[model samples]
Target chain A: MNPATHRHPASYRDPAGFVFEEDGILYRQIHPRYQPSYEQLKQSGLYDRLVSEKLLIPHEEISQPNTADAFRIIRPQRIRPVIPPFCWTYNMLLDAAIATLRIQTIALQHGMILKDAHPSNIQFIGASPILIDTLSFETWIKTKPWIAYRQYCESFLLPLVIGHHGVPDSPKLLRAWPGGIPLETGRTMLPLRSKLSLHWLLHLHLHARQSRQGDTPKSSSTGFSSGQMKNLIHSLKLGTTRCHAGNKHSGWTNYEQQVSARGQYTSHKLAVIQKESAALSGIDTILDLGSNTGNYSNALRNISEKIIQLESDPQTANALYEKNKTAGDQNSLSLCLNVEDLLPAGCDHGLIPSLKSDLVLCLGLLHHLTYRNYIPLPDVLNLLAQLTNKYLWIEYIDPTDPLIREHFNPERVEQRLIDLETFEKQLETLFTTRYHTQLADSSRRLYLCSKK
Target chain B: MIHLLYLDPGNGSYLAQVIIASILGVVFYFRNLLYVVRDFFYRLLGKKDRSADS
Candidate 1:
């Protein structure tokens, strides 16, 4: 492993571990202190088999001639895309949860258990999720209760359940508190029927009580027998099945009610997109940011090879993922992402993260940033301009437009309005405005800007 | 005035379940001139179910 070019984020938690990038590749450096567990991981043949099966990324043991840290560094394989939890669609979260359970089950068979269960440790490669933290596995201790189970449930399971149960903002709530929701808070929000259930009663409510148990520690340190561990893994599999069953599918389901767009207006807007996008060829990949219910995104697929329909709302995004999955759409994909907190163009700083887009379809998202979020119009346009490569497809709604007015009471945000002319001028700076026209009587203007 | 958001399966997420519930609540409580406009508002927003039954 080359340490000269390696950059380690000092803020990373693990003391015996540090991440480094060598030769445009990212790798986790396991220290001498953690070598015993690492060797056990390799000696047991768990690492080789897992990597061969693509259950885990494989890494060759590279020797680093570093005398400073007094520990040899081993470079393990790395996942290219390190997506944070907030970027995941509900289905991705659900899958990651199942993947975690699967890994835990596999680890138990290898006479090991994962010490960490943070959702951040999981990453998505294509649609499949994998456990990226190689060091999370440790020698199995038969005498301790599954301490990480509750933590894993909190980090992965609860937010998914809450989101599916109509608390659309559950991810945000969980995001706000990274340690996962306090059991007390979950107890308050969880329905009474859930509280009465055996899992909730013991794992959640009782666990909370045990945590609150002052002097006397709550649960004894008695470990599960090998058979019990197997049973526990089976129970985890059952939980994953239940979680998957509970996830409802639909695109931005709740958000559609919040926005006001007449059918005529939406159709007209979509027609303009179709007309503009149809002419472009070899430009197979299209990204429709803020794609609610994927109405327009669904149209773009006829022109492009694949459409990545992204929406921020969980309910909506979840719906989108399910729809495409059920439709057996091999070309179109949907994801949940707040436009502002978009997955960065690249994961690591120096190395290119390989998110190349041929076209960007940004429609009806202007008011969301400008009026609702109080972001300046120029700033919103600037961010959109950065995302596009060859062609920029966009729609701009008149600030005084009825649809815009309904979303934001003009009474409160009079100054927030930006006329079409002003927006056009800004686009002229970076993009050659190729397509610009009003759609129906909605006062919505569509613009197709070619990179200047 | 308070909106109850209903998140469910099969409904095109075009209408977040909460806004519909809220609009229904509004029409039930305040039967006035604006109620017609409110219905129009919901319809225009595509919140009014076109195919799927609530």
Candidate 2:
């Protein structure tokens, strides 16, 4: 092993291999115990098929120093800015469930089976979901039932159904129970109508009852045929598709409809963004704060190499994600997160930065942070300074504006003394103003600033 | 005589999946068969609901 290589903390659970990083590059070390399955996976052409179909992350073998207890070292194409389970939207979780079924179906076609079905094994790159765990495949036995069946039900099936049934907090269930939500817990929490559905009755209610009884049939891998396994996979696919199709629209699903209410204001905002963004050079990554339904990010899509759309609302984030998926747009990634309180521990055990951006956009978000959230103006500026290494494009809304007055208390605003002059003075401590423009017929102003 | 059974949670879940999936497969086959038979009788009698054409 290389002396500088560091093993990721989350990679400790899997015995087949562990992911390690060496000098900014991520690599997976395959154990000798997995040599047979790894060879079979490649020789059977499963790896090539999955990669071509964009279902799995592609990797290339690398000759590293470690040789004693390792069969090989492979480095996969890193999926940047990984979105965690807590940050996933309802449709995003459903998309992940569908992707898991697709991976299992493809594996079965190549005479192999997925040994595990953990949600962490899958990550979204833009709108598409890709399997990140390369060692999850194993040769299928003749008569054995799928070992990952229960895990699939808990992690993918149950969560999708819960989210579709209007539990916006379903993603938190995964965080609370990493192994997966307990079947008995799911049975108790699901609505009465859910039990009447045949899919739920079989997968959740009966499964939970049987699990509590602890009844095991005799082990027989000999009688299970490939056709039977295919049937199981098909049933799971149908269940997941039904869940995804049944997702009900909630808060902020139609947020874009309100943007057209102020046609001139929106047009002017777009023009300023396009003109100011044109001045930036060598821009690689962009972080759009409060990216409600990703309208501005979609407008500036051609300006940056990649854009991470961060929205605090799950419904709004999912609306953007569905659009991205339909367009096959690989440049924009949407995540559900509260910008005011980002958890550093959640970012792969602090191995990666919680947020990275070459240019940060704070359009139509500062007033809410300062007035609604009560975060001080200087502190908000400082946070933005830490997030971006280069430029910051921000919008300032006057307290007297009709939109601002509706949401703020006049006495509170007067008490805070958060005027534009005070804000500009505070902003100067962290960023030097490059350009400023005032919107037409509004108390709104856009500023382009560089970190001081 | 009554027999008591004991098994770990893992094996128990696997057994449950096998049983449920097998039953579902058989039920689906029969359900499809019933639909096919109903359609056959309708065709033989040359009787179809007016709403079906719409």
Per-prediction DockQ comes to 0.01, 0.13
lDDT of 2 by residue, A197-311 (tens): 7777788878888778764455333246565677777777777787753444555677667667765888898888898888898788899989987777788888887898888
Task: Please report the TM-score between candidate 1 and the true structure.
Answer: 0.71
Off by over 4 Å in 1: A1-5, A52-54, A60-81, A214-223, A244-287, A295-309, A324-335, A340-359, A371-374, A386-391, A399-415, A434-443, A450-452, B1-54
Candidate 2 chain A weakest lDDT stretch, 10 residues: A343-352
Per-model TM values vs. the true structure? 0.71, 0.89
**Candidate 2 deviant stretches above 4 angstroms:** A1-5, A64-66, A215-225, A245-251, A343-352, A415-417, B1-12, B35-54
The window of 10 residues in a row where model 1 chain A has the poorest summed lDDT is: A346-355
Question: How high is each candidate's interface RMSD, in Å?
Answer: 20.2, 12.2
Each model's fnat?
0.00, 0.19
Error of 2 at A99 (Å): 1.2
lDDT of 1 by residue, A236-342 (tens): 45544555434353434655554444657766777778887788767867778888888787877777766777787776776776777677676666666667654
DockQ for model 1 equals: 0.01
Best candidate (score: TM-score):
2
